[model samples]
Target: MSAHVFLHLCHEVGTSLEVGTRRDIMDIINTLANQMRTNLMMTSGSRREGFRLVESDLDVMYWPNSYRVIWELYQSHYYNNLSKELILCDGSESRPGFTLLYLLSPRLYSELQRACVRMKNRHYISSSKHRQIKCSAESQRSTLHGPCVGRHHGMLGYDLAHCFASDIWPPSASSWIDRSHSWPPSHIVDDIVKRGCHFVAIGHKLEKHEQNEWRISFSLAEQKLVYAMNHFQFLTYGLLKLILNRIINNGLGDDDKLLCSYHMKTAVFWAIQQNIIPQWCPHNLLYSSLTCFKLILKWVYEGICPNFFIPSNNMFLSNIYGEAQNFLFIRLYELYKMGIQSMLETLSITSCNECIDFIRDPSISSCADEDVLFSEADFDIKLFREVDNQGSFSVSNVQKCIQFLHIIEQMIASPLTQNQDIMLQKLTNSVLQNLAFMLPLNTYTQENKLKYRADKISCHFLKFAAKFGCISDVLYLAMYYYKTFRYTEALAIIEVIKVKLSQPYVMHNFNVDEEMYTEAVGGQSWSTKMGQAVAWNIKLNNNILYISELRPEQQSSLQNDVPYLYIPPFVMLYMLEIFAANM
Candidate 1:
């Protein structure tokens, strides 16, 4: 194909995330990260680098300080029991959150017989569901199969990950490949070293312990590369992901898990390492993307996709076999020949839907009353000198809180009207009063800060959307602003709502729920059905009914002893009510 045609196709596939959508994603991530500080951590891919297309996942990591604490407990009782196995804490009885990893030597695995004896004595009485004992051998080699997980709206899901910190790399260097002064800018390098690298245990086995190895991951390094990319280079990576997901992967069927977007990423990394930057100019975006595809094909043919930092560690070594590799190579070749036409056909519907949704979501628009936002808002609030600390919050109380939130959500979601102002005021006052009453029930982490005053954080976020007026969600945006003391930003969102009436605000996507199903059944039809049933039951029981914990398997990997990060529902509703009243 000629250069013009390729670049045109690149433009079509290289759609970047919209400004508002990007901000919303970041804000959601920040809120979650802050709330779950003791359990989960957050990061981004295409969303952060600005070259995101229709197909991208918001990847994050889950690691509580408790994981480290539990590991230390086992470490303290180290001994050469003929079984050589270290009793990593059992996570079987925990809630669905994150997995507990156990590092075992060959000698230990044999003696432990896939079972750990309960420790005889302990200094402290344990409250965590995980036991102080050895674990059975995992049914699958991949950590994702065993314990690696994330939760969304009470459902469990999977996202890409590696270790948080590694022992092999230079502690000071920014990027993983610190030697010889390679491609990424100096600033990028500095960031990598500061953030550090993680290790992924590959080829974990029950019978052959010697086969296991630690693969050094340069995920942080790759993110730096994407961020540092010129506009054209960003397009190149987006096109590559499109090709992998639509062409090669679709050909392998939905059940196929081999050759993910990460493999394509490593191929691009390898090309850059070989000094292919000159060929990766803006005009040659499609050409560069094609070149990376060829690199992937070469690796697939040889049954080896090298880790960018640690070349000896092959990423595709276990994920694919000869038949699968050959099949993928052939499919990718077919896609290369089809070229721009194939991408246009494959991405048309998905891209169009994304654009349509981006325009629909209101969190992107400002709700300022005039052209500018106000410096201060005047909402009636009765500050209490003493809190109403009550009995232990029961399931019924939580159900009531959820009911109130749902009611407010429906009211805000309805179309705007002239008389709605008085109703909003009353609703806000009522919510605040109830929230004040519930405040004492929440066990505050710190008594000094007003931020710690509310137990359920989401309550402070109750938003009201008005036609050509400031929205309730904007009020939520205001709450975060108020907490950070950015009153101007908060007022700006509030003011915009007063100016122009617009379409009803779209609900935030609970995309993670779908991911939870995918992880539960590993994407098989029969098991997927089973997983759906299990998920529905869990959601009904844990969320709608407020009567249960996660499923045993789901709970096995994710639950922890760390106090729950989220504020109780009552506190969240109260805060949202107050926010709406002031707006």
Candidate 2:
């Protein structure tokens, strides 16, 4: 292909406006949902930032609301006394963008105390101790990777980092404010500064007290900056990551960790901010990518990949020196000399042949259709899992239910596209299902009048959810009826679910019975088919507030930290029918 055609193909494949918008919508919804949780505030990274790369891990940072990190002593006054434990950032001994956290709270919680060590009559939280505790507290299958505890079981493995929230931006990164004048614009910069940063449980590797120091995290700020990027710039960033993972870091062992996704991100940030590429557009996509690559090569050559926020903090201080640095530099230099065509050809030869095919033809092929269906299935499964993962509603209090209702209302009031609307429908279904269970559990009273009213309301909520939910979700309503001693009503819903499951188009997990699905709804729009498609699995979130009735039978499943129980619709239908008959 000619250079013009190749660049156009690259832009078409990587810089998809539709894909970017969908990702933005997903992020907004997730961010809103995460904000409702009181105990731990979760912020999504990587994939949530509008890139739908298959290799991207689900990166999340969560911090408890009870603890607060402050830059200055005076900032403590803004927090309510006894409400939150204050941790002061002491950057004196640590490197720029890393700080020693001094426990400013008069009474340290046992967990905090355990992670703290006294130095000069003041207790400082040990990063190593804190990270150990956090990692150990997670599932045994999780492996510790720097500040994150990673679980590698699902379609998309996730890395969970436990961090401390700082309301004030770190002084070390204060230079970032002045540096963002050209690219991010004043409003974006102001928003990032106001949102501040986090302190993750990993210190500067070269620091003397590395165990007691916390590296400043710009995850939130970085996310904002990414959101601010135009499609061309975003795709350029994605292309760099593709090079890093597929070309640079390919076949490198765990210990041979040299270049990281962050390095690529920092390079992109600097490139955009510095206006190294005068115009970032489809025609200049390859040029932009090469510019970023050149910058990274220079950094690798110098053995100094500077942190974008704090340029003084050399990210390559720990590694990327001597033999490793030389190897990386040579590899990058060879690729650079070979030019963009060589790199594209190299990518085409990789296992991800679909990427090149996608570049060549932007239109959805038959295989792409199947992939899209599977992607939608995965998205739905993830949405279901996130609902279950959020702190469950207590049987005694319906506060969480109320909060979810508020969130649902907010989502409805906002303007949404068809895809987002469908997502909202699914979200509404999940929330209402949980609320249905919670209402019955919390309002169950001996007063016949009140009990009857609550039961009626609960049933109505379940019915509403059933309208928007998958075929399997209707079983929730059936289960609710069975639980309430209304066996006949339950059996009726079970019969409906049985009929729906018999349909050839019903999807289950990632398994796409393509021939059957195509025959059923081949000509229909994706949104139409998506609306009609029913999942085979009846997902009961393993939360006592939602599934208290199932506790007796699901004792083992509940005891473990599994988010949801995926029972086949047929099995649930039959089981509920048998139970209703016996009753």
Best-fitting candidate, scored by TM-score = 2
lDDT of each: 0.41, 0.72
| lDDT at residue 189 of model 2 (Cα atoms) | 89
TM-score versus the correct structure, for each prediction:
0.49, 0.79
Q: List model 2 lDDT by residue over 416-526, tens digit each.
A: 765566566666677677777766454445587867787877889888877766667788888887787778988888777777777776665435566676677566653
Please report, as a residue range, the 10-residue window in candidate 1 with the lowest summed lDDT: 378-387
- Distance from true location, Cα of 565 in model 1, Å: 20
Q: Any idea what lDDT model 1 has? A: 0.41
Residue range 156-195, candidate 1, lDDT tens digits: 2224342333222332222345552666767676666555
Q: Which stretches of candidate 2 lie over 4 Å from their true place?
A: 1-18, 21-35, 74-85, 108-110, 151-156, 348-399, 410-421, 435-454, 481-491, 494-536, 544-561, 568-583
